[model samples]
Target chain A: MVQLTTDNSYGTWRFCAWNGMIFMGVFIVFWGIMGHNVPPYGGDMDASVIANYFRDNANLVRLGMAISMTFAVSYAVWGISIGKVMDYILGRDHILTNLQVWGAGLTVVPILVSSSFWLTGSYRPEALPDEILQLLYDMAWLLIDLAYSVTSVQMIALGVGCLRDKRAQPFFPKWVCWYSIWVGFMFVAEILMPMFKSGAFARQGILNFWIEFMIFFIYAPIITFYQLKAIKRIEAGEPAA
Target chain B: MSDEQSALQQSGRAPGDPGVWFFIIADMAMFAIFFLIFMAGRHEAPELYRASQAHLDSRFGLANTLILLTSGACMAKAVMMARAGDVAITLRYLLLTLGIGLLFGVSKVMEYGTKFAAGIAINTNEFFGYYFAFTGIHFLHWIIGCGVLTVLIRRVRRSGVNAENINWIESGGIYWHMVDLLWVMLFAMIYLLPPGGTA
Candidate 1:
């Protein structure tokens, strides 16, 4: 049986993990307020139209990216906490655990790189040529949308681990395991975004953008809900056998 | 016999584990979202949707629907037989379910082949996109359901419908029924409904 100690360090990590949803919620508000949400969806305009918006809202864009960066870091922490529980479930180190951590760690890259690009575009939109600004904007969206495979890998790892749990009361319920797998499968649709400029498969399309975002938003909360419960069980001295 | 009855009584509370229901409910909700999105798209382009819908063969959809419904019936019979400790009969029903499921799969492939021959594809239009996306996903579920049926058949054959194995058999049957239910909706929405009407 695997048991976790109810100590200060573990307590703090668990607390951080539980608050992962807050970080994401705040990030969404900031991003929306800064007007970065709409332009990328193609619901509003092309890159040229958005370049002007970025040029005008430079300071807001910079602030949004900085705040989003914090959320990215928080997400990594949450991922680590999930990996820890998964490790306990397996009772030993496993490649899936490593994949979860690695995938979570690499997820930060896209957010960081995308935010940096947006920041650069907004930093001196006046100094940079319009085409250059447009290029930067497109690059940011591509990284954010297409780089979803990293998160998919993380989902796959956690899902597989959960399904493999053989305990009477598994650390994660079987449904959550299937949900994780389904969410990971849904991200495969992101690959179609670059090929379509409009319609459901496009970046701004309902399936790819709206439904995908809704799923992503719902995913964090569900995982955090289950993860917090699992942590509480561990803290209460429940064995992983 | 009492033991078997008790097992059946237990399985009666839920066809599968609570977790399986959770997955099914969530999956249905997601499909509902897809339906809503597809409907909204149709509203935006009624004529285009109608033209695209015309390209789909309703008979193929009807055929697949009948196949799945038959398979689902066999699945139900198999579960009943398993609960009665009739392993041989249950195996027969399971095999019948598997065969009908394969027929459904074959019908789907033929439908897709015809569409491809006509140069229709997922990206050809909004209607085609929804057609392929919705049916394509349901098709994946069918494939999974077939696999589950295969496992259940093997388990019943090996264990002969013991108390321990009954729960799994019931779970797989429930999952197959869900696949069938979803197809009924898909068949009606994608094939039977008028292009401008709601599913």
Candidate 2:
């Protein structure tokens, strides 16, 4: 049985991790109801089409964006919890742990920035030209979808660190490690998205948007589930192995 | 067979850890999504898909399928031989499996080369986009599986066949079978299917 030598108890941050899940649920519901979710106004719709959509749902969209911004804060809390766990496992501050922390911090940027774009577009749909509205919409999607490197790096760092836990009962199960690596690699597909206006690689296409989104949604919950379990066992003073 | 071997055989259990199974299930789910999306694309443009598929070399696809199947058979044999306590024969079968797996990789690279030479790319069309995306991802899996196999070979050589090592070897075999099974589905969808008709 491997014992953690750190003085820090992971309990407080574990609660924060659980709260992150709640924030995720809030973001999903608010975004789905108000932000129009992905493929806003249907994936392939033109600038005029999207502009009209914002015109109709401006109030709801703005409210949704405002609420969704909170999701970034939730993510930050979750990321810190993850970094703490990683540090605990390694018994010291390490390069990969730092990378994971930095990556987590950077991930909040896209969500916050992108949601702002959506908010700006919805704030005055009547005053803004269709082209400008479309530009904002495009920028929002590009940041959220194409700027995936930070998240990918975070996953890789966490995954690699988890795989290093060689105890009989590892801090993370091996499957989670492999899952992180595979899903992280999948983010590379986003690079092709900007080139295609249609097809599976398009911004709203099946491979790029739907598949990627579903994977991320499931990935987070799974990690959180395992994390909670690990914390419970740790609190019980069970051997890590 | 030794009494110990017989006792172990009677204990019915799946090879490898439950973690690998979890990984496999999740991977299959992801692939299922890709399949569904591909089907949807076909429904939208039957003619384009059919035309694009026609350009693919079915012969090459068939050859690759055969190689993978044969490799799977060799892997199965290697597991059996290892269980029977015949380390040398197990090594032989494993080597054969690795050889055939590499052959499949080579064929895939050649196929991509031919496509590139003819100016076909992911951006060519909807059909081609699915083609490259699906195959490209599958190819990456193949590379990883090969790496797993190589590691298994090294471990077996260093530690010799034993209870613990056998479990690790079996896990590697399971991963290889997954790669093979995925390729079979891909070959049918990308090569054998008449595009307009569902596979």
Scored by TM-score, the top model is 2
Task: State which docking tier applies to candidate 2.
Answer: acceptable
Looking at candidate 1 chain A, the ten consecutive residues that score lowest on lDDT are A1-10
lDDT (Cα, 0-100) at B36 in candidate 1: 86
Q: Candidate 2 chain B: minimum summed lDDT over ten consecutive residues — where?
A: B1-10
- The digit string of per-residue lDDT tens for model 1 on B29-118 reads 878887888878878888888888888899999899899999999998888888788989999999999998999989999999999999
> What are the per-candidate TM-scores when only chain A is compared?
0.91, 0.92
lDDT of 2 by residue, B1-199 (tens): 7554576578776677656676777777778888888888888789998889888998889999999999999998887777777788888888899999899989988999999999999889988888888888888888988898888788778777897678877888888999999999999887877766755
Candidates' C-alpha lDDT: 0.80, 0.81
Deviation of model 1 at A42, angstroms? 1.2
For model 1, the stretches where C-alpha displacement exceeds 4 angstroms are A1-9, A15-19, A30-32, A94-99, A127-136, A163-178, A188-192, A199-201, B1-12, B86-92, B150-164, B197-199
Candidate 2: count of backbone clashes, pairs at least 3 residues apart or interchain: 1
The 10-residue segment of model 2 chain A with minimum total lDDT is: A1-10
